[model samples]
Target: MLLTAVAPAVWGTTYYVTTEYLPPDRPLLAGVLRALPAGLLLVALTRRRPHGVWWWRSLLLGTLNIGAFFALLFIAAYRLPGGVAATVGAVQPLLVAGLSAGLLGDRLTARTVLTGLTGVLGVGLLVVQPGARLDGLGIAAAAGSAVVMATGVVLSKRWPAPAPLLAVTGWQLVAGGTVLLPVALLVEGPPPSSLSAGNVLGYAYLTLIGAAVAYTLWFRGIRELPPTNVTFLTLLSPTVATIVGWLALGQDLGPLQVVGGVLILGSLVFAQLRRRPSPAPVRAAGGPAAVQDLNA
Candidate 1:
């Protein structure tokens, strides 16, 4: 779990990197460069291709987890205040908890629901500033991002990969990058004719560290940890982002923000304390085989 926590924590740096180093108003291009090269690198290293249903499954998962999620998130960032979009996206843990109950047969307790709500409230306090304007389209996009990402998390657990972890992650990245390539070209036009050393470095950080390493760790966490648990870790992203801003960008670190950060941390610990049920026994052919709950 500590290792899994690293993924979102590193993701927090993206905001700082984008604002300070990346070119202005070119989110799609950033997404493409971030996803595609890292994906191809992984594929090259693993030297594995999708087999059977994975070709289509990879595309669907890629769309949900990466392509669509990134697009919608970028739209929200453009249209809504970052605070509002993040607060709205906080509903992801709740969505994941409910989905786990329905699809994964995990028990949904009052504590879990309350904890999820606490996370949302904490994020709202931490980020939502006074008089932050709202755009309906941005709210929709943020909500959609939450839904799609939650579904992707559940579906990833529902469908275990036959291939190795890097291979599976590579496939999703490639598929997502492929989907993003055209949208980026059509909407954003070609990449910038020239990039500075800083721009190059920022893109490289996003690709190698942000997507490649972080996602590998994230997918490993999904395979090893509870889905609800994994989803809750996302709250850390904003928390870390806020801290980075305060420390690095000289943003204000008010009392309320401190309180909000505390709440987020407390909620994360509380959620992790939930008691997981034991895996059920399964009989295969002649012998008994245990059907392990991967989420457990």
Candidate 2:
């Protein structure tokens, strides 16, 4: 659970990293760099490559998780204002709730549904400004990214991996990066000719901490915990991002966003409460509470 919470906190840095460090025009390159090299390094360290069924699984999971998710995320960020893109992405928990029920046979508790809805409402409050114009393409991109990420989350749970968490994450990154490399080349061309220290450090942070470290923790936690529980943790990302934005980048947070942050946090706590296991039933001298009452 700590890992689950921390992973998204790290991920919250991505919005800043992409905008500040990486070239604005090369979103694909950013995605590729984030996934591929870190993945290969993990693979090399583990010396455990996927074969046969695992290869297909890695490809599918990687595409949905990293490739499609990152591509759409980059596109949305490029096309839309950050707030709008973030709000669209905030729909992820809702998507995960629905998909987990269908794919994992997890019960869709009413409390969970309500909490998730509240979280969405909070996100709306936080990001949707009055009289702000909408970009159709950007909305689609962010929404699509959420769906792809939801699919990946469900599939990853459905298909258990044999490799260690870090190794599996690495393979998925490699596969995602490989798929993106050609698309990036054809569509976005090569990266910028010159780079700066800040650029290198930002990219390194993204690759090592964001992709490698965070993902290993994420997958491990997902494998151990329920999908809804894991998804609920994402509520923290926007809040963290907003804080980081304000503190690091001097972005301002309005009253509405602050209220929204409270709502999101409340909803997350509520959802977690719903998912927590109840204490074991206690037996009385006569019988169980309902049973004893019936007898009495």
Candidate 3:
């Protein structure tokens, strides 16, 4: 889960990067640049293709995790204030926890439920601005993005990847990029006729760091960690973004942001508290092998 945190933390830079260097009115194009090229690079490098059910599974997961989610997220980001957009996404933990409990049969302890709520509250405090107005479309897109991403993560955990992490990530990336390709062309038109050096650099950073490296680690973590626990790590994105702002953009944190940080950290610890491992079954000398199996 610690390694998985790197992905969201890397993603924390997206808003800043998009605003700073990427071309305006090109959200779908940005998604293409961020997902397609990097995915193709990964596929080319691995040359390990998915066989069997993975072909369709990759498409579904990619649509949820990358194609639809990125499109909706970009819409929300452009339509709403940054803080409001981020706050909207902060709903993911609760969604993940609920989906894990209902669909995956993963236990939802009270601590986890409360901590998930705390994460939402904490993120709201840290990011929501005073006068953030809610756009209907932005809200819908933001909420839909959360639901799609949470569902994707839970499904990814439920269905273990048959291939190695790189191959799995690459497959999904390609599937997702392919899904987004038509949308990008339809909405944003053909790729920009001209590319500035800054645009090239921004695209490269997003392709290499944001998509390839971050997603590889992300899928690996999802393959190993419990779905709900893994989703909790995403709460760190806004925190990382805030820290980046403070360090790079000279933005300062307020009192609420400080308190919000504490609550977010505290809830992260709070959720995992009292998670004792279940002990192995002990076999009695008189017990039959079948009886031992039941206990196991």
RMSD of each: 7.5, 3.2, 4.9
How many backbone overlaps does candidate 1 show? 0
The residue pairs in collision within model 1 are: none
Span of 10 residues, lowest total lDDT, candidate 3? 267-276
Runs of candidate 2 with Cα error greater than 4 angstroms are: 275-296
Q: Give the RMSD in angstroms, all C-alphas superposed, for model 3.
A: 4.9
Worst 10 residues of 1 by lDDT: 286-295
Q: What does the lDDT read for residue 232 in candidate 2?
A: 82
On TM-score, the stronger of 1 and 2 is 1
Task: Give the top-scoring candidate (lDDT).
Answer: 1
What are the Cα lDDT values of the candidates? Answer: 0.93, 0.86, 0.86
lDDT of 2 by residue, 76-141 (tens): 888887777888888888899899989889887777778888888888787666776688998999
* TM-score of every candidate relative to the true structure: 0.92, 0.91, 0.90
